[model samples]
Every structure is written in C-alpha cells, then in structure tokens.
Target: MEKTPLEDWIAYKIGIRPGSLSREAIEQYQLARIRQTVALAKEKSTFYREKLSGVNPIKIMDYVQFSKLPFTYPQDIKENPLRFVCVSPKDIDRIVTLQSSGTTGEPKRLFFTKEDQELTIDFFNHGMRNLVGPSDRVLILLPWQLPGSVGDLLRIGLKRLKACPLPYGIVQDPEAAIAAAVESGANAIVGIPTQVLGMARHRKGKELAGRIKSVLLSTDYVPQAICQVLKEQWGCKVFNHYGMTEMGLGGGVQCSDLLAYHLREADLYFEIVDPETGQLLPEGELGEIVFTTLTRQGMPLIRYRTGDVSRFIPENCPCGTILRSMEVVKQRISGKTILAETDFLITELDEVLFSINGILDYQSTLALTGGKDCLTIEVKTERKNKIDPVAMRQVLHTIPAIQQGLERGTLEVIVGESCEFMPISKGTAKRMILDTREQQQRPSGIQHS
Candidate 1:
C-alpha cells in the first residue's frame, strides 16, 4: 500500500519543508491558524462576535483551551445564516440552501467565496489521486448541473489532475448509467452507496464487472456490506469518502490501504467529543465529530458540532503517513429512533438487508398501525417474481431488534416487492428509515410505545 497523497499536499499547503511533517509541526500550525481564525471570526461575523465575546484569542493557545469554547450547532445556521458570513454579499461566490423536511422553518444557507471553493477543489484533486490517475476515465454519478455542486467541483479537480471525468449525474436510471460507463470505457466510478449497488446488481451489470477498476462512494453512509458486494462482484477497489455541505463538500477520503479516512487537516481542525456532555474524548473513543475551519475565509465556523459519529484511529496508519485517520462514519447521532423499546437505526437495517443476495434496494417505513409499531419494507430485486415475502420476513427476523420486537408483540413486520423502483432526483435526500408516527394520529385504543 502507498502512503496517502494528502500528507504531502497538506504539508505543502501549510508551508512545511519536505520531510518535516510531524505531529508537533501539525499541532503548532493548527494552533496558530486556530487563533487567526478566532480573531477573524470575532472581528467580522456578528454571530461569532457575540458567541466569542468573552474569550480572548490569545488565551486559547492550546487545544485544551480551544476545546472550552461554546459549540456552534446546525440550528444556528438554519436560524440566521447571514449572521455567520464574514465577507460581504458581493464577495460570496455561492450560496447553498438546504431545506428542512417541512416548510415551517428556515432552511440552512451556507455561503462560500471563490477562495473557499478553491480549497475544496484542491482537496478533491489530491484526495482523488488515491483511486484515479492521469488519463483515467471516471464516471461521476452525482449532481453536476449547478455551478458549485459537488460533482462540478469534482470535475474541475479531476481535470486539474489530468483525468477525464464523464459526468452522468445521479443514478436515476442504473441501466443508463452502466451503459454510459461502457460507452465511455470508464475505469473508475464515483457515486452514492446504494445507487451504485443497484447498478452492480442490474442485469447488464456483469458486462462492466471486470472492466471498471475502482469505485468511490460518497454523499451518504457507505455500508460495509455494500462495499463487500461491490468488491466481490466487480473485483475492484471500493473507497469511502466522508463529507457534507457544511464541510465545503470535501472533508476526508480513504487512501490505498482502504482502512480509514485521511482527513484534510490543513484546512480543518477535527475533534471527537461526547455528544451529550460536549466534553472532548481521548483518542480512539467513539464520539460526535466536531470541526473548526482553519483556513475558510468566507464563513469560518468555530467548533461546529457535526452530529456525526466517529473516532480518531489511535495507531499510526500502516501506509506511512503522519496525518491522523478517522474511522468510517457509519451512523449519525440523529439517525436513531426509539421503537418498541429498541433503538432502531437505519444502519442496523442496512447490515441485515444488504447482506442477503438478490436484494437490489429497499424502502423502509415505520408507523403505528392497529396499536402496534409496524415496519413496512418495499424491496426491489433483480428478478421481480423471485423474491418471496415469507423468506424476506425470515431474513429480517434475524436482526436482534426485530426479533425482540416480534417476541414482545409490540411490533409488526410486513414485507413486499416493488414492481418498479424509482431512483431519487439530483437534489433529493438519500434513503433512510422513515418514521411517520409523529405525523399519524393515534387511535383511541393505541398507547404510546
């Protein structure tokens, strides 16, 4: 395995001489940048000015002191995004508005300047080198029509790296995407997790199994089951990427070792803290992911709580890089729901459903029906007529939560097949367990679980 290219790229960006990249040097640079960012944020942004009014930047000389600052939450952005902008509107290059589920609340709006976007493009350029190289044709199955969308920025990054990008957008039609890959002779693919799995399980999927050399799954959670299936079917490498709209679309990516993520440390300072108490945890302990922008100029967020769950790897990477690594994020703190006295998570369902062969995709819905917590699963398979509902229920029962729920008679499970599966649109949200009990009115005899 080769060392991650991000090491050299980050070192160069921070002005560290060759062969001088160490934990101490990185920490010193981060401390200096953190103070600078604090000063900048306090001077320009109204939200940060009030939030950090009591603290002096010079006093926060160490990571321990920095961790004592108040956290910035997602709700802060949704409430009044403009208050966080450091630059004037004329200098803002792009504004990404993320709508909430209902129309009653304001959506989150993230502002970015040209330089801010350039930082993301630079990270993508070097991070992609782990899976793609010059002259390689890669299929991009993400949103690219917008000016500053992730796919569009990735295209620019690949072009800078001298690779050919075949922008196919999202995988609305798996067959069409596979055809595009075949037509372009694409050697690598970047896409969402389940959508790519659908492509690999398509009838014509076998055609490109041996031809495609690598895959990069992003924009959503990457299930290990999906990765195993992709590797088994295509005999290719599968890489996982962790990012969101708040992180400027590129945070970290896996190296050739494929063990954990090599974070973009030069641009951001990452921390793991107890989600409930907000206390920073020691290395190797699982906790919520917190990040502070070290180099962002447009809208620098200090100690932003990401709500994501992961931990820093305590051991140094075998690939020989000093840059820290984080475990692949498998679940979000907000993704879990209490149903039938069980903590139900979408990842739990993913582990059970995706492991079964012949399952292409599934849609799960949880609701209260007839005084019981009911779970309805609409499964899509390669062969429409082959999936047996009883067998599917049997497989679902293998999950400990489902088994306990069934045993207690507090839950009911229903399994069926979808004749046609409609893929999500470019701007739509990714798949997850839909809990509709809040919207549904309980009957007279039903009691809350």
Candidate 2:
C-alpha cells in the first residue's frame, strides 16, 4: 500500500515527530534530496536548466557558485513567468500568486502542484499541532485576503484539525469581525496584528475575552507591548509565526521568547550568509537567511534568498520543541521610500527607536504628507509619562536622507494610535517601514486625533 502524504512527510523529515532523525541525519537526507530536486529542475524546467546549463548540483558545494547561478528576484518571475514554471500547465493543480509588499517594484507569481499542496498541508498540520490542540476554534482575523493564496491553504489546515473556522478578513469591517468572534464562540484567533487589535475600537466584545484561548500572529512581527495587552485582555497566549510565500510557509514560532522565528529544518536546510559577501556566518551572527527546499516538486527553490535579517540562538526552546530560534535585529526595517529625490531607509528609522533606553514599546506608520515629496512619520508609544518628539527629531535630523526630506517640508511627525491599529487582528504584527509610508500615501489614509 502507498504511504499517505502525511505518513511520508513525517518519515522523510527529521525532528518534527517521533521516529524522526537528528540534525546530522537530516543533513545527509538533504544531500540526497537536493540532488534529486536539481536533476528534476534541470530535466523538466527550461528556466533553471538554461541558467544552470553548465552547473552541476553536486559541484555547487559552496556558496559562491551557488549564488552565482542566478538570484530569482520577484521581477524576473513577473517578466517571463514561464521561466520558473517547472511543469506543464496541465500538470499544475493550483496557482498561488502574490502581489508582494516588497520594497521594490511589482509582485511575483508562484505555483504549486497537487503534490506541493499535499506537502504544505502536511507541514502546516504538523507545525500547527505545536501551537494548538483539538479543542481550539480559530478566528482568521487578517484584514486583507489576496485571492487564491495563504487564506485558502490555512483553511485546508484548519479543516484537518477539525477546529471551527471563523472567517475574518477585509471583507468584514473591524466592527463586523468583533461581532463575528462574539457570535462564533471562537477560541483562538489567527492573522495579522493590525486587524485583530482593530476590533478593540468597537469596545463591546470585551465579553468575548475568555473564549479566545490563543492568538496565532503571522505575516509580521509582533511588538512586545502589543503582546502584553493581548494576553492581559484576552487571557490567552500569543504565538508569533513568521512565514513567506517564497519559503512554502515552513517556519518556526516565537511563543517562548520575544519576537522571533526559526527555520523549519526537518523539511529544509537553513543557512545564514553575509548578505553582501554570501559567506556563511556562525550562530549568533546576523546575516541574510538563505533556504533550500527539500520536498517541494511543483516549484522547488534552491539557495533562495529571503531578505529578512536575523541571527540564531543556540539553546533549545523552553517550549520543549528543540527547535532553533532566530530573532530579527539591528537591520533596516524600512526600505527606499524615496519621494522628491530623498530616500529614507526603513532600517535606520527602526534602529533609532529600538535602540532607545526609556521606550517600553512602540508602533510606527509612514506617510507622505502635503504632496508627492512630503513625508510624515506617525509613532505610538506605550510609555505614558515620558515621550518627546523633539528629541526624536534631533536624532532623525542627523541622518542626511531624513533631514532633506524634512527640510523640504516633506516630512511631518505625528504621535498617536495608527488609523489602522485596530484590535481585531491577531498578536504578531508585520511593520515593514515601507508599509507605513505606503498606507500614508493613500488618499483616504490615516485619520488623526
């Protein structure tokens, strides 16, 4: 009899469940798996074979040749999409494309075979088991849902869990979502940080408090203070999960520590390399995380570059999962949001606030003020007593990019809750520096106090 997909995945990968191999054994398994994937890509896919014409997968034993093969940027996929399609159109079972919130231009298209879908279901099923039990009712409170992507996959996983599914998204306004949660008797909430908290504006669902047992925050980083309020008000645990459309949604959680995510090793091999140099870095060192997917067939990625900057911690998780953890730190949280010849890097701004001594917690949104060139920053602080904008401006003025944007009357600073910072979303929040700026540029952008 053929082994079920779930059975095969558990047996194939190590450290995910019982009978799994150790990291050393998983490495050996990966070598064979990588070779198989490369051959499949070269034989069937023209895009990779042409780029990898003279390249041998085994000969790519080091990082230099590996990166030299070709970096698969989102634009490349958008331009000549068929380049990345590994199988025939008929062979494709489902197509999951995304308009990237990437700092750069255009969105990319991604595909999954019937097999790839099965594998994703298996991986998320195993991963979710760690975060939730059978008695949970999950409220997917993300504000936006891109058609034919993550929300559907999550629904598949939820079905397998036999947990009640509470559909929540941009379709439901914050007030509507709060009413849904109250009506559905949902025990756990899952989604972006903004939408979950957005519901707090309604102020009537405080009675739904004890029903929410846990909050699964994804697609962003959860600030520390936001998590505190979630636990205090909801009387539940906040589990932060980080995933990317490129990475097949296989990643770890930061429930035990502050905001952190770990790469799922059983199904893929994780490496940290110096972003500029591509040289592998040791643990506890910050670098660009690169991934090589093992079991994916419809669309397999080798040495894929995820732009996130993170460093790994060496100890075991206190949650007892034995999974290694990675934390985002000291990197550019924002991107080139250049308006009027001046570009403000998100990284510099985040480092400025995060490095401060007195700040307990914070959330920030970026906006373009007055005109195409004008920029405004809206920041919210949890500290009640001591918050100063002038001091913050002095620190910002030193940076040439920010100062020019300011001197031109293009930059404005406002302090208070974000117009979108509602209480209806989940725990962990995704606050890339560009998101704030992009939201501000909208015609009906944030409304201030």
Candidate 3:
C-alpha cells in the first residue's frame, strides 16, 4: 500500500513535477528512488526476486547495476506471463494486454494494472492539454483493433479536457473517414498520418478546411510532407505524438520540430545509450533508447530495452517546461544498413529528405547482395506523373552524402505506390525500411534474459 513514486512526484509540494528542481537535485532524488524501486520489486515481484537473488540494489547505484540483473525482454513475459504478476487477480484493479508476437512467430502477451492505466491517462491528458482548450471537439480515428487501449484512454483524456470525443474504430475507407470528420462538426481530429493524409489530399477536407483547429497524428510514423499538405488544406495545426501501450502515452511536442519532445520523466527515466555497448552515450549521440518506469504497478519495465534508437537533449525544454527533451526518434536502429565498407543510418537520410516538401510519402528498404547494400526507396505522390524527373533528381540526388552513396550504388531511390498507403501492421507503421540483416532485428525486439 506504499504510495507510487510517480504519484508522490506529481503530488509533491509544487503539484507540478519533481523536474521543477535543478538538474543536480533531480538526479540525486532519482538515485534514491531507484534504490526504493529495486527493493520494492525484488521484495514483492517474484520475477525481480529471482533477478536479484544475490546482488544488492544499494551496491548497483546506477543503470549499470540495474541492467546487470538481466535484459528483461518481451519474450520473458510471453513465455511465463502469469509468473510476472506480482499480485493475484483479486488485488489487480484493471488488466490491459497486447500481443507479445515476434517476427513471423506467435504473439506474446502484455498486461497492465489499474495504476498503469491511470498513469497512462495522466500523461495523455498532460500531452493533450497542449493542443486543446475548453471549446474544442475531438474525433478519434483509430484502427479500433482488439487492443483498443490506444483510442480508449485518449477518449477518456479528451473527455477530461472538456472536449467531446467521437471514437471511431472503423475506418475501412480512409476517404469516407475524411468526409465524416468534416461533417461531424468536430474541431479536432486524431488518427494515423497515412489515413489522414489520404483525406487531406482528397477534395472534401480541403473544402471544409476552415472549421478545424488541430489535427493529431498518432499511432504511426508521420511523413513531413503529409503534415504540410494537411496544414495547407485543412488550415489547422497538425501535431505529432509518440506513445505505445506498454509505456502509456509517453511523449508530446513543443510547437516546432526543432524543439525536442517534452518527456514525462517523473513517470519514466529516459536513457539514450550506445546501442551496442549499453553504456550511457553522451548527449547528442544517436543511441538506443532504454527506459525504466519509476512507478508502474502492473508491468514495470526495469531497464527495458525499447528497440527504438534516438538521442537526448542535455537540457530542459525551451518552452519553459521542466520536463526533459528527447528528439522523438526519426529512425529505429534495426533499419540501419551495414555494408562491407560503410554503415548507413537511415534516420539521417530521413531528416534530409523529409525537410523537403516535394515528396508526400516514402518507404526505404535495404537490399543486400553478399555485403553490398542498395536502398529501394518507394515514394507515394499525389502528382507522381506530373513530377519532373530531372529537376526532382537534382533536388534529391544533390544532397552531399546521400548523393555520394547513391553514386557508389550503395544507395538507390525508387518510387512505388503513388496513392494512399494501406495499413501494413497493427502497431505503428514504420517507413518500411527492409533491413535484410538478420530478419530478427525490429524496432522492438523479443530478447529474454
């Protein structure tokens, strides 16, 4: 019955955040909480009990000792999910689950207690408070699949925001969804970028552009071009959010892409490390992002290696928010290409190309012959036939590094599927970079300790 660390931090004297303190104070407090967490999990949770049979958490002051316990991956829970439960079903308040599926294999299981769900709502509400005010109405456009948590809690938070939420899990036709949002008299829209982009390009949303206030792009990777087109046609601000069911609604934005995300740090500790070494990488190093939840009663990921690769900003947000800043990752590490000579981080390529407004949507794949790698780039455009090949190539091929790599045949750009892109997978849709490295590496991996 001990109070959760997250609840304590949020309900602290300021009733704002533990992050309001100076950097030195926050780290000192964090280390103390880490000690408390390790002790609590080890004492109450059998999984962590076996994990720390001998080592003392006090001795392992930082992440090094924390990670040494074992790499707690999704598969460990999937194989023995019931064993992961620290409490019985009678004590459990709520349960949330997701597929623990691996690549071309059986899906794994995920669970959440009521505490976990509320924390998720808190962050989602905190994130939404940025876009909405008292007068707005929201239309949530989600896949509405079995693990309905994504749209579920978002609806709850929107309700808490004093906004009307019309949750639509069915969008069999993207074009029709566009028309519905226009006619629903809703002021705001939230859905995947792919489906929303299809609507934005359609003539209907363009016709009803003046009525909307903000368009939220969620549950997928958003191409900048789609954001631009939506902003232009819909005449509303297009906002991007990064979150997952396991982590709760984790991240939100700061008006401009240049400003890194205002991370919900008190709930989760954000660490960007050398992807290979697991050593804490310095700020600005594009490293793998691993997380530890300070207070998740259901399924606390202690040093859980989230398969995404991103970097951390060494300072607080410029918008006067005390929450830490993280560059919501542009590329996942699994998408990188390691040829016989050079390794290409596709995220850097995305930064260069997505900044240009000419292209609408793109998918990058790595083709390997022995050790050589050629990139197959597919682009979706509204005006594909009208595009200037020479002028377009000059703009695309002129980028100093990408062009050099293209000349060496290590990089190739080819466009495919010029119209709207259908959903590829259940979770967030990556740019579809086919890295034929091991066929095992994904944005999130299923490694068991």
lDDT score for residue 309 of model 2: 67
Model 2 lowest lDDT segment of ten: 421-430
Poorest 10 consecutive residues by lDDT, candidate 1: 422-431
- Per-residue CA lDDT of model 3 for 359-387, tens digit only, reads 54466666544344455666555555644
- TM-score of candidate 2 on Cα atoms, chains taken together: 0.74
lDDT of 2 at 120: 67
Our tally of clashes for model 3 stands at 4
Alpha-carbon runs more than 4 Å astray in model 3: 1-29, 58-70, 74-79, 90-106, 144-148, 219-221, 251-258, 339-342, 345-406, 409-414, 418-421, 436-449
Q: Estimate each model's TM-score.
A: 0.96, 0.74, 0.78
Inter-residue clash pairs, candidate 1:
none
Off by over 4 Å in 1: 101-105, 423-430, 441-449
lDDT of each: 0.87, 0.60, 0.62
Model 2: CA > 4 A from native: 1-20, 59-70, 102-104, 142-148, 255-262, 320-322, 328-375, 378-449
lDDT order, best first, reads: 1, 3, 2
lDDT, candidate 1, 50-142, per-residue tens: 999998998897999999999999899998999999999999999998765332466789999999999999998999999999999999999
For every candidate in turn, the CA RMSD to the true structure comes to: 2.0, 7.8, 6.6
